[model samples]
Target chain A: MADTSSPPALHFTGHRHLVERLVLSTLTGRPIRVTKIRSSSVTDPGLAPYEVSFLRLLEAVTNGSQIEFSYTGTALAYRPGLITGSAAGHGASIDGVLRHEIPASCTRGVSYFLLPLCLLAPFSKSPVNVLFTGPGVITSATPTGDVSVDTVRTAILPIYEQFGIMNKLEIRTTQRSNPGPGGKGGTGEVQLIFGHQVRLPKTVHLLNPGRVKSIRGVAYATGVSGANNARMIEAARGVLNPFVPDTRIFSENTAAGFVPAPERNNAAAKRKMGVGFGLSLVAETSTGVRFSADVAVPVEGGVPPEDIGRKCAFQLLEAVEKGGCVDVVAAFTALTLMAMGSEDVGRIQIGRDVLGSEDIVQLARDFKTFGLSGWGLRDAGEGSEDIIVSIVGRGVGNVGRKVA
Target chain B: MPSLAPLGKRKRPTEAPKSAPATKPAPGTKAAEPESDGDSDLQAIFKRAFEAKFAPLPFAPAADEGNHESAEEEDEDEDEWTGFDSESESESESVPAPVVVVHSTPSRALEIDKSELKAFLSSKPPTAAKPTPFPSSGPKPTPAEDEDSAANLKNDVALQRLLSESHLLSADRTSGALDPTGKNRHKALDLRLQALGAKGSLFKQEKMPMAHRKGIVRKGAERETKRRKEAKEAGIVLEVAQKAKGKSVGRRERAVDAPAVGRFRGGTLVLNSRDVASIEGPKFKSKGKGKRRR
Candidate 1:
């Protein structure tokens, strides 16, 4: 690992880089300064409540973190002070955990703030349990690129599992609240419980995603006629039933982990009801690689449900055909994990033109910022297959994770 | 966590895994290298890949327990930072103390039942049961009706069976059809089987599948369907629960399903889930082909 003793201060404009910057800064013990948030954009300028709430949430996790925000709300200086985990001699027992149940500000998805926690949880001295209250489903009002259970399940979980730290992962949607964009309901609550301590990931070479083994999905309707769920399943299945060998769809009545379907009295509930429907599909390969795609029912109509189903099915097909251990969306996330893993060979197959994408290449640059090395982006040399981003974690791992 | 081993061991190109491009070997890692041979990872990957592809896949990938310890006496003293201060720094004041717990949420630890945990680790929703991890009998027969055609089956065991009948001619080739390239003599036999039709069956659509015809989702889809049925029964169950609790007003909720409109609480917890419908792969390829070809 490179020395972080004198790493320069990080500067950013707008709130876009907030999560990534915090995640990296926390690990490296560096300070970050974010300035001019939405100064250029006149429409809804300055920091939103969600951003402030995000900072407050961060404060709740750490013991003594310094956060200085400008009066105009344009400039903010954050110096990570203390990480709250476990006490000494408590390093080996997984029982030592710092639990914080936060009432997440409803302006955005909990996934936005959850990323930093997920990344930092492994390295924290103790396991972390954060219960967030926010819109459980992604909506137009939510910030763009906010992750959900979909990405958390397919992207983050797999990366942690490779580190032999999977036994404790739990992200159950305990309660469904107000659907986002516009709706009136109780705020949804999701409890994300994970980690005892970081199990430094071993060197991995995940080049091939292998063949698609099974494709399954769920179609649910909320505040609308339950029949909509049936239509979605039928339409999605119509598109998926030709190529996939094993396909299944769950409806409002059958989707797993749900408390149970509620009666839809559109006339009675009226304005209180938020009408929406969606489908979630996962294409799992023989090699343990999973590609997931989903579609939410649109507020506007005439866009057939068949198209939604077809889009999801094809997205998964592309993922499998791309032949990577990680899906395209998950490629960067996996690279981030590799950069932060143990000091052994780690490799992942991102797309052939992965380096063409600026964000993907930024991963290498970000690793450099953390003062970690023995990593690079290189051609897998299999005649234009997905490029493999390789790394050796500084072996920076925490102790005292008890396996309950 | 990596133990501080002696650093500055010269690079062994022959030992590095082929799959890994170990660029810019850092100063702090070689000392803590646990595997005796670096090439072992490359070999293990190839072996695992071969087994995963060639043999049946239900056989899980093996875990390397780091047994390859080879004692090597260091010849040269390493760089100044090679002796590494990881141990001391790890125990620094920045260490997080396990306090400040908010008792609002459920404080359940990872005491998951083994069977239940396995299913969760499988990454399926809670409704999905644990997949049977084994191959029965001699050669595992590839089941009829790949996932594509199986969606329509939807728990109609009879319909599912009909969709997957052996459509091709028997190995004996009594029907005088030429064998195809695939290992299965009846690979496309179902089509011909349907064409030939069952004895005394009048119409093409009227013909029923052989009672024993198989499907790949022998257990899974059945269980999924059964689960779906049970979930449907949950409505009645929900009513029962409501009657038992005698609460007629509040709306019910389901996990990852459609949003259940609970009685409008003043405080709304708005967590957003991303819609997975967006992808234009073909358009992306065509648009980027010329720009990315080089």
Candidate 2:
């Protein structure tokens, strides 16, 4: 498969949108070469630890994937491979689950790796089963703008149901953690099982985002008092009950996770990490669309649970006030599936502010670079600020699933 | 207890003059009798009884006029009252004046449903729609609907019987009615038994002689062949003839109490090659020689 006749690699620069580029390259079976990744920075002028860890995860799930880095780690050349997900003898353990570990020095949340991996799971040849356990798995929201794992399960996963891939999808978190001191690492465990594989995602035309019918939430306190969860639930209800009376928040309190903090002489010393509380709110509309908000205490730990809960509630209100069928957090996943669907026009309504965000606009440019057609946009014509985006699918879906 | 009596009398005369001049004489007369322990004792007893049934009263000069009349009538009874009762009455009156009622409400403890907790907090994502609980017993059906349902059930059974019995009527259609007393009625009854899963026809002769059975089978085959030949000569298409099924060659199961090997007869057991082979069980096949090996 590594012959000279392979297509020329697409070129990209800068470290921004690196995950999106790699995901597109894998789905399209094309090779990518990214240069000048954090090249201007003096102390860290290359791909970060989390990025390298993500590349390592990509290699574990796929077969024949090649990754090459320069001396300074600025330039990278990645050749695509077949997504043989969790198949026996392909870096998967005896139970047919690929275990990916994040380093203790990594700062990003676990959702950073989970979101893109989910996009590739449905197109893989076999079912994707991955268990994420390590010291760096932060289950809560981080200061770097990543959502908590609860939002990923309650809000983002339900979006795949509309695309005809709903069976056997589950996300189990045996342990919960917030970011450790200095927002570096946490000890957490999470497992993702995506058993539904389809050749093409069904085209969707979702325009009407109905009124919010109910609201559900989770208030998690790790290594902290259970009263913090009660306080957060009360504060969040104070803001959300008047708008939607069917609000329920479940409380979860677990002991603080401990990691090995051994010194030169003491080999058995362990310190507690991820001691904080957070709230995750998901507002589901009558049409089954979901909008989510997350707020967690910083690692320095001065914020009260009331502030975190109120902030999360107001953030959920803002997400709903944006007025679209898809939330800004889930827009990328929805749009990517539409672009990879069968050869037909799939239309979805998105808020103007959501579409104007940096991540979604860059996603459009990346799709164009991959040789896909441009999107067609028009006003939703409901006296609102929503824009209906119509995308044409690539018709080349699930290259690994073609044999089946 | 007696120390506050003078103070009570002094304030009463001062407030009484403000309401009316008519009441001034009453309070002035009460003040003159301030040394009378009997009058103060009766007032203390009345105050305790009132406070027990209702709220404690503040200083009311108007009620003193009514109590003065009752005081004269109960003067004899007050003398018989014990000294311990008067002391306890004074103590009760002192506490109500300085008492404070603190209204403390307990915090509400929301009881989370166990089923709901299992549904939402489990590993799987929560289902989109909540399950609506079904009513244990539905409302009683109206009399009109009940009668209509019963009538429909009766018609359904009648229609089912007609569908199965209509073939019997078609065989003798010239009469245009049911033949209740003819051979066709017996045939219809046999068909009903077969429909109910009977093993075989009751009219079949199970113990006929072998020669008689062979002759009957030959006659039936000859009649079927004759009809097919005439139809072919007349150039009329006929239905295909069905082949007779061969007898099964499998062994019959023996009774449980019988011997496992050859049959026992005349006080001696008879053994055959087939029976001996059954006792020895199956032999293994040799791949090289294409033969069986024990």
- Find the candidate with the highest TM-score and give its number: 2
Extract clashing residue pairs from model 2: none
Those runs of model 1 whose alpha carbons end farther than 4 Å from true positions after fitting are A1-8, A85-107, A134-143, A181-186, A252-274, A299-304, A353-355, A399-404, B1-294
- For model 2, what share of native contacts is present? 0.39
- Backbone clash total for model 2 is 0
Candidate 1 TM-score, C-alpha based: 0.52
Per-residue lDDT of B190 in model 2: 81
| Model 2, span A264-383: residue lDDT tens | 899999999988999999999988889999999888889989789888989999999997988888998999999999999999999999999898999999999988769999999969
- Alpha-carbon deviation at A287 in model 2, angstroms: 1.0
Using DockQ, give the best candidate's number: 2
Lowest-lDDT window of 10 residues in candidate 2 chain A? Answer: A237-246
Best by lDDT: 2
